[model samples]
Target: MNLFRLDASILPGNSASAQLADAAEAEWTAAHPQGTVTRRHLGTDPLPADAWALATTASFTPEADRSPEQREALALATALAEELRSADTAILAVPLYNYGVSQHFKTWADLVIAGSDNPTEPLLKSTPTVLATTLGGGYGPGTPREGWDHSTPYLERLLGDIWQAELTVVKRELTLAATNPAMESLRPLAEDHHTQALTAAREAGRALAGI
Candidate 1:
């Protein structure tokens, strides 16, 4: 079982999103002790800003007329898509940054789609996917920030709507409560949410691997 794990978090070891992802990945690694896992730290190794542009241009231009840079961009996009193509499962760990999806992640997704759009492709056709996310605050109905979370739902659209992956999501909210003085009162709730998210992530990883 090939596992393609991608994490897009600028906070490094301090990222709550990474913690949930680590929990899930731990279960996956245990279940696939002999299976290979590919890791992409997208925040640190973001795709070039022009990757999507070059990829799209290369797709439209004749092979004979493609520039060397355009050809390289296409190749890079293909390699990125191949990570998903070769994987049986994936963990896409993302964080809600300023109430929106990570720029690095958006760029990566666009480039992958540009390079791989065939409906018959294996990767975009029901590969099991786990979306791990962390949000700085609560966004439940009636909450002050009810409509603030845009990243998690965007990921849902990309994986389920666009890519057609069988998806599961595990997220931890109020992540800033632990570190922000203004949110101190919510710290206990944050801890509870973290525990629950980790538990769900572990269970999802194990169950999906079994299937």
Candidate 2:
């Protein structure tokens, strides 16, 4: 079994999303002791800026007429595609930024989603995806900005559209400790959510591992 951990947190140790991802990885490791796990920290090692340029160029360029720059660009896209293709399960940790995913996460998504001619093949097919997200304010299934919850919804759509993969979302909202005293007092609540998310991730991993 193979698992890929994509961490998109930008705030170093202070990132709640990254914490959840770590917990998820730990849970998965414990559940499947024999499985192989690979970690990709987009916050630290981001995709090259030329990824977009390569994608765009590849879209129009013929194989024989491609320039060296175009080839490098295609190579990067292919590399990201191969990573996703090789993984049986993927764990994505994304923190909400203004009700949306961080740019780092979006770039990673772009790389994975761009290489496929169908836009969904590389992401949704047989792979299972677990999404862990943290939000500064409360907004979920029925909330006001729920429609605008660019992180969860977009992820669900992308995974479903591309790979037909089953997706499980574990979201923690209203986590701005400074602004919301109630949120600040909900450390236990957040911890509970984290635990639940890890449990869910483990179950997802086990299922994917055929255990």
Q: Which ten residues in a row have the lowest lDDT in candidate 1?
A: 117-126
RMSD of each: 1.6, 2.8
Clash count for each candidate, listed in order shown: 0, 5
For model 1, give the RMSD to the true fold.
1.6
lDDT by residue (1-211, candidate 2, tens digit) is 7898888888767887776666666666777889898788888888887686677677688888888877887777777777778887878888889778877777777776666665657454667777778887656666565667677777777766556767777677666744567667767665666667666655655555555
The lDDT leader among the candidates is 1
Q: Which residue runs does candidate 2 get wrong by more than 4 Å?
A: 141-146, 178-211
TM per candidate: 0.95, 0.83
For residues 6-49, write the lDDT of model 1, one tens digit per residue.
99999787878888888888888888889988999987787899
Query: Which one wins on TM-score?
Result: 1
Candidate 1 CA-lDDT value: 0.85
- The global C-alpha lDDT for each of the candidates, from Candidate 1 onward, is 0.85, 0.73
How accurate locally is residue 201 in candidate 2, as Cα lDDT from 0 to 100? 56
